[model samples]
Target: MEKKADQVSVWCIVSMASIPLVMTLGNSMLIPVLPILEDKVGISSFQSSMIITSYSVAAIFLIPVAGYLSDRFGRKKVILPSLILALIGGLIAGFASWKMDDPFTMIIIGRVIQGIGAAGAMPIVLPLVGDLYQDDEEKASSCLGIIETSNTFGKVLSPILGSIFAAFLWFLPFFSISALSLISIVLIFFFVKVPKEKDEPVKFKEFFNNTKKVFKAEGKWLYTVFLNGVLVMLILFSMLFFLSENLEKVHDIKGIKKGFVLAIPLLLLCTASFISGRKIKGDIKTIRLVMLSCLAVMSIAVAFVGFTNKKIILLLAVTSIVGIAIGALLPALDAIITENIEKELRGTVTSFYSSARFIGVAAGPPIMSIVMKNFLNGSYIVAGVLGVILLFIVFKFIKENEIGNQTEKA
Candidate 1:
């Protein structure tokens, strides 16, 4: 019985690790090819941006509901269906890119479907990890950290992979993403084993009542921190999107050179994530310090990007600093949420976190694009202001609760 239990635990951890890989690979693989799609599909810059926004819009709205369903039904049930949907969306996008007369619109539609499916998969995975670990907060946190690292790894490799695929054919990246989604589906179905809920199903009224009770619980501060973390992610992505556009349009950088330039900050981010994963051993204060410091530095970087014409060296330095901060912060934030929330309510809270992130992801690009294009005083001013605001929120509102308390330690 002991050996069997150990084996089950190992399998659960492996299954949990797979979730982030799927999510990260699907998204990251598309970044390098955005420029290509714009040219190939004959879309405006703003319309090209919709490829990202459409997916995020769907994810923002759908993740909370998906989280609730996962809690009510089971993680495996939700995840399996999500995989199928994602696969279908990927195939549609690929086929559209391959044959459709209006490729961009079809691609966006397919991405929206993919986002809807991802809503069910990505957020629930962390909660599933929490469910699997039950009492082991440390292990659960470590698992979440590893999952985050996998995500970063995917991001790190995505540009190179996307470039290679795009070199072969504009539509190949979509097909590659589809293949990965299908593989993920098979892996989860065969390997993951979520335990069925022992409690009887609660009615809708009772569900809301329970959720309200949970919200009113003393440790709501964690939710605030998580939300702020999501904001930080938005700001980071906004900066990246703006930078990418500026590099291509203003600086005349394109193709693989653009990919390489964009990759610099991600390398720093990858390093920071790795170091944080090794050192962040349940110290909430330490985690907060790292996160806030990164945001502060990121603010400075944004300011720098606005004024500098040196372009290559200056942008690289500032973005590298910002990337490091983001890398250290994300896993810490995720672990905090996963470790602090109660098991029964984990899905709901994680879903909320996902929603916040999706909101940021959806809003970041267009908001930055508007600020950069219309607000002539220099767009970096807007980015800098956002960074400063985020820093203030993190310092003033995000409290570091006691680490071991799972009930209300937000």
Candidate 2:
């Protein structure tokens, strides 16, 4: 039974990891091709950004509902259907791009469907991971790191892959996402083994009561995590939007060249997330120290992007450094939330966290576009300032608490 559980745990981790990877690829992959999409669809820059934001906006609103459902039902039950919705969305978007006279509207609609699916899928993984290793904090922490690494890996691949698909045809990326989502669905259905729950499903009234109780007790620290989540994602997507736009508009770099160039910072981000996920484990001290240091590093690096010139090498170096900071921040935040929350409450809490993150994603590109249009350096300055604000919140709220209780697992 022990060996079997270990094997199931490993497979579950792999399957859960794929959830974020596919989600990132579905969204981030389109960043490099937004210019092409703008031209092909005859949309304004802001409208093109809406392509990305629409998906996140939908996810932002629906994520908490999905989280609640997953807690009430089961992870796989919620996840499998969500992937199906994403697959349907991908196919709809791809078909519209290939055959329709006006594909933009259809594509946005598809993205909304994809967002609904995303709301249910990735957010459920954190709590499911907690359930898998109920007693072992170290293993759970390492597993969560692997999950974060996969998410970053998708970001690393998105630009390169999206650009490659766009080179052949602008719609190919949508088809690619459909294919990826299909694969994820199969992997999850066949191999991922969720541990059986012994407790009866909580009634809606009790669920709400538990949720209220949790916030009353842990609201300060949890709110800090939520804010940090939004800030990091905002900084990340904003910088990516800036880099993708600048590379094509200013340097005339496009196609695979642009993709590879855009990927440099994300590669660094993936590396940072992988390392941080493992090192932070379940230690609250580790989470605090890592987040504080990384937030400082990110703020300084983004400030440089705003303050400096359009020198290509300098921008890449600074963005790459910022990527490292974000990478560390993500898993640290994930560990803090997942390790501390009770299993029944984990999905709901982390879903709220994920929703906060989607809000950042939804806002990043459009806001950055407006800022960059007005003043090139202003975007980076704005990101840096936000980072500093988040750092202070973390410093003030995230403190040493007694561990060992299920709700306060340190």
TM-score, one value per model: 0.90, 0.97
lDDT of 2 at 248: 88
Leading candidate by TM-score: 2
Q: Write the per-residue lDDT of candidate 2 for residues 73-179, one digit (tens) a residue.
A: 99899999999999999999899999998899999999999998899898988888887777889988999999999999999999999999999999999999889
Ten contiguous residues with the weakest lDDT in model 1? 401-410
**Tens digit of per-residue lDDT, candidate 1, span 230-333:** 66667666666776777777788776677777778887787778677657765677777866887777777666665553466777787777788778887777
Model 2: residues with Cα > 4 Å off, grouped in runs: 1-9, 402-410
TM-score of 2: 0.97
Best model number under lDDT: 2
Our tally of clashes for model 2 stands at 0
